[model samples]
Target: MAASLTLHPDRALPLDREQRAVAREIYGQTAHLPLICMHGHVEAEVLASNTAFADPARLLVTPDHYVTRMLVSQGIAPETLGVRRVDGGPTETDSRAIWKTFCANWKLYRGTPSRYWLEHELVEVFGVDQVPSAESADALYDRISERIAEPGFRPQQLLDTFNIELISTTDPAGSDLAHHAGLARQGLGERVVPTFRPDAVVHLDRPSWRDDVAALAKVSGTGTGDYAGFLDALRERRAAFAAAGGLATDHGHLLADTTPLEPAEAAAIYDQALAGTVTADQAARFAAHMLYVFAGMSCDDGLVMQIHPGVLRDHHAGIAAKHGPDVGFDIPFAAEFTTALRPMLQTYGHDPRFRAILFTLDETVYSRELAPLAGAYPSLRLGAPWWFLDTPGGMQRFRETAVDTAGFYNTSGFVDDTRAFASIPARHDLSRRVDAGFLARLVLEHRLNLDEATETAVDLAYNLPKIAYQRRI
Candidate 1:
């Protein structure tokens, strides 16, 4: 018999009787507050098109690295999960087969955040009564297919269903943002926005760097033959994004280093990169220098600068070569923010117009580095626990470690940095519950009064993200 799935009212709350009561109260206050998703990877076209999702497997399994990575670790092939190969090799073509593969291996996701989110999507979003299992896989798939085919299941409609006040999509630096323009025509521009991400052109080491630069030049109407024009092009694109209702820019780098190179030195390296003569060291230095330049640009444009460093992207050479990037091969390394960020922070830390949100996969720096840096720098705010650290336990540890130094306001609220649009509310809901439990403990300890805890819960769930991302600035 298939186990009946249920969502407990007090799921993710404190275990202690006294604290659980307080947590339930705290969670109730903000459970229905509209989500403010300041950073995410959901493509803007998904909302703009308002098309019904193609199928259950493609929507739920193939694109979610969290789900795919676990299956891969268990020796299941990516192709079996319907993740297409870069070489145009054959993968599972039948969406039903892919759904069965994921459902059969459901045990692999136990105790994982993916499990929590997936279960939430199944129960709350799709109204599935049976937990995913080999026996229930076909029924669940058909049920989900029928649900998605309904008119209300379209992406745009789900935004209202999810109670999302606003959601930002990460747009490449060279993107013309036609989807954003389309949404604007429909008067949905403010509710669905773009965030400028320039990593492709800025990171000179990428194999397609030159091509990306050419694209950026074309879109921004600037020449990329010189370093000066490159900077101007980036500035122009940032302005374009801001005009599209963008409130922030996203940066994902291997390290947090933000040292500035002299103008002559920077131009020389840029020339080297253009000529294809730049060494790895030169490329690294140039990427670091761009961070400094971008900081200055933020001060001028008022677009909040969000940097989440310390990810070693595409750790597996084989997987990357086969599946392309963001297939869950990214790994975290030790992060040094105090020293690595000093150069940029010193220049913009006190600037009223400059705002930066920092995230790290390295939890060791929560109190030691990130909290201290955000606490002192008026322009700095700690981003929500990101990537691998966005789990429930991670969210709890983040509040405990960073709040003591940075306080609740200095930390941005939850940003469901997800490619899976259906998982957004689940991610935010988990963060809220974890935060409620954490705050409940504080109240039980008399560290915060009930009124204060309730207010802070609301801030962490909604208000802080708007303030941190300059959405309300």
Candidate 2:
């Protein structure tokens, strides 16, 4: 069966061998270009310490819910896969057992992107080719576990091996950039920096909002019990992030909705939020005002603002109650970006001095809502298809809808937008192949020339992200 299989180029309509060969050639040309990862949520300390990866399962499987969720969907238990419980309850201690559990369920990922990424990591990264099923799990685990103990497998070494030019990680508002500063003190050649993400402190409706705000005050030396002092602490943290090479701010909100509320009304609501007396509507208003406040700060601080909205994060109440956030329970919801952002958009949307990149999990917004907004607004640029919409089908649908109006330049190019380091190159490689295959179709249809398509491919893969994030930071 393995000998009978032929590799296929990523596409909407599949292509024949000649087309696949051309796709491979195009992909080969740009495969080694330095990676420009403008957005992600990796812990900065792991890279700063430059440690060799732990056992393969811990480094690769536990952090990436993409793999865990797929395996879980096939009836594998999260606890068995080493997913941590929010209540501090532990899982199986044996890492090899976790690998066996995953390997036994590997068939669930067949014909899925996870399968592609995993298989590539096996053959290209670990030099193992046999498909990872129950029969081969032990051999694969032992080999990778041994390789993980090598110096060449250190995080920094992998960065160099992957040719990553600049990487940014998300940190909460109160986090001191001590680790990032340490990395800078070491004088690493490539840039690895923080991006300010204030969700914990800003989302006052969260059950732990008061505690989060108190933490912010503790870190930044400002009184966060009041609105004015809380904002002051946040601004100070932003300055620290900038000094430590932060170039941007990232927002994960339920909606792209933003508005400015009357100061007196906002202050009263903030008091209630601090006292844990806010209602659902009050929570939405509070989040909206905070987003607007961040927008104003970005105008002053010169940080590129990124908003990823339309996610009903932790939709599974049981999972959220047990395992906390980003536990594969975050699902796509309908969004109203054009109207939702009108209040903030009207005020700052025309300002060339301001820059905000908008991302949505709601695919229906791509053409109807997002493209027109990005096409018209001076402050807004459409972010790459993200989260649920970050698939081959998702990317294809995005280009089809957004490019016709906003064109490629108005878009911010490809971002793997993943926390999985083992899968990063595979993610980027998948994007490049998809782009090349799309361009090959364009050339065949006479919609674009080979030269223009080639240039576009390079920009999508390399130049645009560097320029976009650089121009702001």
Candidate 3:
């Protein structure tokens, strides 16, 4: 018989039996609520097709960077993980072999949040009573593979099983959202929605930036060779996405500094950009101006704008060249949100028409930059503890620094921010559990009423992410 996998509860709770029961009670209260995933990177194609997933390794091991990075760290190859690139290539081919390699390296995840999530998925989702290790790996893998290949384990079925009411998939500005349209026509309207991501069009320094903008111009039937035309093209695309049920726009800029340049200056920069002769500063200027242009568009369109700044993307040149992005190579840099967001916020913050949701990797700025800005501005709102800080320690740090000043309402709720399908429930469940632990602290310490903590817990898990992202469409 396989041993039961142990759960590592947070140390914040007291060691006594009575306190642990309180923790259980808090979890029980929030466990059954409908999940709200306002921002994430799960493929729309999975839901649109409603197809059965291939196998356990294909679903969990290969596609997830969190899994692959750890496995690779333990001497597993990226090819073994089945990561695909733009050129239709991968390092490894044999699915069975990949599963074997992953199983051998499963101990790499010990004590990680991934370990907890994966164990939960194995036990709860797949009915695996045994712990996953090299010893029982093949038995667990084969059973999971058999179940995933079944009709009852299809994407839609899994979504329903996971109790996901609202999920937002991030899309590039140039995207036609054809899959999303298909899903809606199939009557999966509330199940999935797109969030506008102008990264491809706005990040002028990106390798394929000009071509992506050109694609946008052609698809929207608007000329983007010039500054005015570029804005018009983006606006037209936004309208199409709006009609398709996208609610908010997401921007991942290196800096939050926004610039609304005069037409002539913007035009000159656009000319330089199209000619591929622009300097680094010119590109920054153009990207900054485009942010302002996006805000102006959002005011007219009623789509909430989200700004996630301060990630020094692809920090390791050697790792990035070999592995591309989202390979666990991204690093956090010191960010200045107050002054950086000033150019955009000063112009749009007072306007009720414009709502901007801000996220940061810089925890130092939570109280200093984010809290005060979100607390003061009508357009601005704080996003949840993002990518790096989604862990228990990170969430605690975020709440400690920001909650007192910004309050819970100023901040949006949890987003899984994952591309992997199986991990969604696990991620949301972890967030719910952590929030309960935090609120439970408030009740135990007399910082808040027990009843109010319950309501707040529900809001953090279910309501705030949806409401703050303004994801009606």
Number of the top-ranking candidate, with lDDT as the measure: 1
lDDT of 2 at 337: 84
Which pairs clash in model 2?
Answer: none
Candidate 2: tens digits of C-alpha lDDT, residues 1-473 = 22212233443233766556555666666777888888877678888898887787887687788888887777777888888998889886688888887877877877777777777677667777566767787887888987778889888788887778888989988787778887888885238889999999878789888888888898898987778888899999999888888888999998877987888888889999877798889889889988998888988888889999888888889988888888787778888887788988888887766888889888888899889988988788888888767777777788889988888888888877888877777777778877777777777778888778888888989987766665352
Candidate 3 structure quality by residue, lDDT tens digits, 1-473 = 65566445543343556545556667777788888887789888888998888878888888877888788777766766777654566567777777778777777887677776787788778877767666777888888888788888998887789998888888888888888989899898657888888888877767788999888987889999787888888888888878887888889888887867888998997788788887889788878888888888888998998888888988878666676776776778987877767888878889878888888888889988899998889677888888877777778788888889988888888877788888888778787777777777777778888788888888888888777877322
**Poorly placed runs, candidate 1 (over 4 Å):** 471-473
TM-score of each: 0.99, 0.95, 0.94
Count clashes in each candidate, considering only residues at least 3 apart in sequence or on different chains: 0, 0, 2
In model 2, state the lDDT of residue 172.
89
Q: For residue 296, what is the lDDT in candidate 3?
A: 82
**For model 3, where is the 10-residue window of minimal lDDT?**
6-15
In the range 183-266, model 1's lDDT, one tens digit per residue, is 999889999999999999999979999999999999999999999999999999999999999999999988888999999999
lDDT of 1: 0.92
